[model samples]
Target: MSILVTGATGTVGSLVVQRLAQQGAEVKALVRTPAKAALPAGVTAVPGDLTDVASLRRALTSVRTLFLLNAVVPDELTQALVMLNLARDAGVQGIVYLSVIHADLYSNVPHFTGKHSVERMIERFELPATVLRPAYFMQNDLQARGAIEGHGVYPMPLGSAGVAMIDVRDIADIAASELLRRHWAADPLPRLTLDLAGPDALTAASVAALWSEALQREVRPAGDDLESFEQQWAHFAPGWMAYDMRLMMAAIQQHGMKPAEGSVQRLETLLGRPLRRYRDMVRESGQLKLG
Candidate 1:
């Protein structure tokens, strides 16, 4: 009766592992290198990769619940399909998949399309799973610390449609809760999707203003220039991945990442607490000295 977490060394995956451990769940982390994976003391680290079938089979053995997370790689869809197929064969009781918000709407983006396809497969095959479609991760802004701190600018072209930027910490909390629910349930759970979003639907201009208020310095949005944003990120990420993200930004511009009606309230009711705000997380993250 153990829960297995893939991408255990990664951002959200790592946080989810910590959360499950704090809740005292029997957690197993699937990592490439178990010796090097810096997981909690009691959490078991299993060596496996999505592409390696034998390793995955070994990892899935005796595990009742799974947190399926895959990075935005070239073989993302392939990896997800393979893992899902394997999960089915292994009779894994419950699965929690980390998907993007508006995955069905943003069909142009590679990762989004992959997730949409995965969602359909889950439904078509009737996998006992919960898909968590999270909004723009507020921590993504942390990467722009150089721009915000060094220059007085927020460079992301989050567009005018407004994104309800969600906090990663809250995502982990909800993910762990779902994992625990599925783990402890006597019967198998049905397929469900949760739209994880923040309280405020923030615009680029408003985000700049929030930074200004928090840092006590004038911070400005770099404007919704998709090409420049892509070019700038191209230097850091793969060229195709950067372009993929630019397309995603365009979709966000056209169709905001706002949650469905009462999704935020539903999430709040589930957690028995308000969803974390973008502004408050910034202050607590210790990324910047609050003014």
Candidate 2:
């Protein structure tokens, strides 16, 4: 069974594509630009957009399984809904959806709500699926290296509550495994949801301390000045995306992306290893600039 990976050019999607290819799975990547997709040698790049029905229809040809990882955008839900309907029409046997942790709990956040809506569609349509709810990507902190290394500060609004940030590599591995499991099963498997989290529940202070130890200097939290976060993103991202991020941060402030009981044990058992740690991620990523 061939697998169709939506958002295959994105951060986690791209990683999943690589893992699937390494496992010798037949992989098809749905991307806007086939010419520029730069996929693995055996992976086929199918030119398509989530909003374009005709394009998606063509991409779904002969695809038995789907990996849906929609980006955060103004029309995210519309894109996901259209893709799900098309996947059903094409007789997609199974789906692996990448949704946010605490998606339902963070009700007011647009992106979180959008993902929850996708999950509902998967359930309502009775699609055989595995939903992966991952916390904040630890690699996203790499983007703040300049702030941490140069200015001695952790710029993200991690708040007093702690988040168990997961590694993208682990997520990709689990996604690939699930895709193959669904593809190989003779009988239709029941729906499952997994909360992907790291080994430690880290707060702003803890994150700052890690940076301090890494860089061999004093580092402080930027505090939860959400307006500044919004302002910073507004300059780079579209207005709606920026506002959506602010809402996410606000929700994080009130309720951390804490995983359910045995979440760590479950992930560790699946991988046969301990979940990746924030300190290890920082060290391995070469974030430390020796003074």
Candidate 3:
């Protein structure tokens, strides 16, 4: 069965493509630019856009499984609905959707709210699907790597709250498992929804301490104020995007992303191994250079 993976160039999607291809699965990657996709040798790169229904139809040909991953855009709901309808029309048998944790609880956050809408769409269609709602990405710290390395500070707006963040790689592993697991034509289809998180729930200060120990520098939490976070992103992001990010962060600061019971254990069972620790990710990435 050929699996069509959308958002194939993104962090999680790219890793999923690589994992599926390495496992000898026939993987088709949907990308805006096939020339720049740079997927593995055996993986097929199909040029398509979620907004372009015609293009998606062309890409979905002979595709049995679909990994639907959409970016967080203002029109995310529209794009996802268009893609979902197209995928169903194309006779795609199974789908694996990447979503955020607590999407229902944080409806005000545009990203979470958008994902919640898509989740409902999948359920309404009654598709043979597995929905993965992963907690915060550990790799998000890479955006603030410069601040941690140069200024020795963790400058996120996550206040004193703890988050059970998971690595994007683990999320990819789970997605691949769903797409690649063997199922006969007569076998019962599994409709699953899983919430994934890391083994440890770490706060901002705890993360800073990890960086400090890893880099041999006194890294500390820069501040917990939303205004400072807004200012930091505003310098590079559009005004509305900066505000959107601030809104999301403020919610996290106020109500931490604590995982439900058995979330980590379930993730580990899916991955067939222990979840990757934040400190281990930093060490293996070779980003912990001493200053």
Write down the TM-score of every candidate: 0.98, 0.97, 0.94
- Displacement of residue 237 (Cα, Å) in model 2 is 1.2
lDDT of 3: 0.85
Leading candidate by lDDT: 1
Question: Which ten-residue region of model 3 has the weakest summed lDDT?
Answer: 181-190
Instruction: Estimate, for each residue in 111-186, the C-alpha lDDT of model 2 and write its tens digit.
Output: 9999999899889978899999999999999999889988998999989788999999999988998999998788
As for candidate 1, its clashing pairs are: none
Displacement of residue 44 (Cα, Å) in model 1 is 0.5
Q: Report the number of clashing residue pairs per model.
A: 0, 0, 0
RMSD of each: 1.2, 1.6, 2.0
Scored by lDDT, model 2 comes in at: 0.90
Of models 1 and 3, which has the larger lDDT? 1
Error of 2 at 278 (Å): 0.6
Please, what are the lDDT tens digits per residue for candidate 1 over residues 195-241? Answer: 99999999999989888888888999999999999999899999999
Evaluated at residue 219, the lDDT of candidate 2 is: 90
| lDDT per model vs. reference | 0.92, 0.90, 0.85
**Pairs of residues clashing in candidate 3:** none
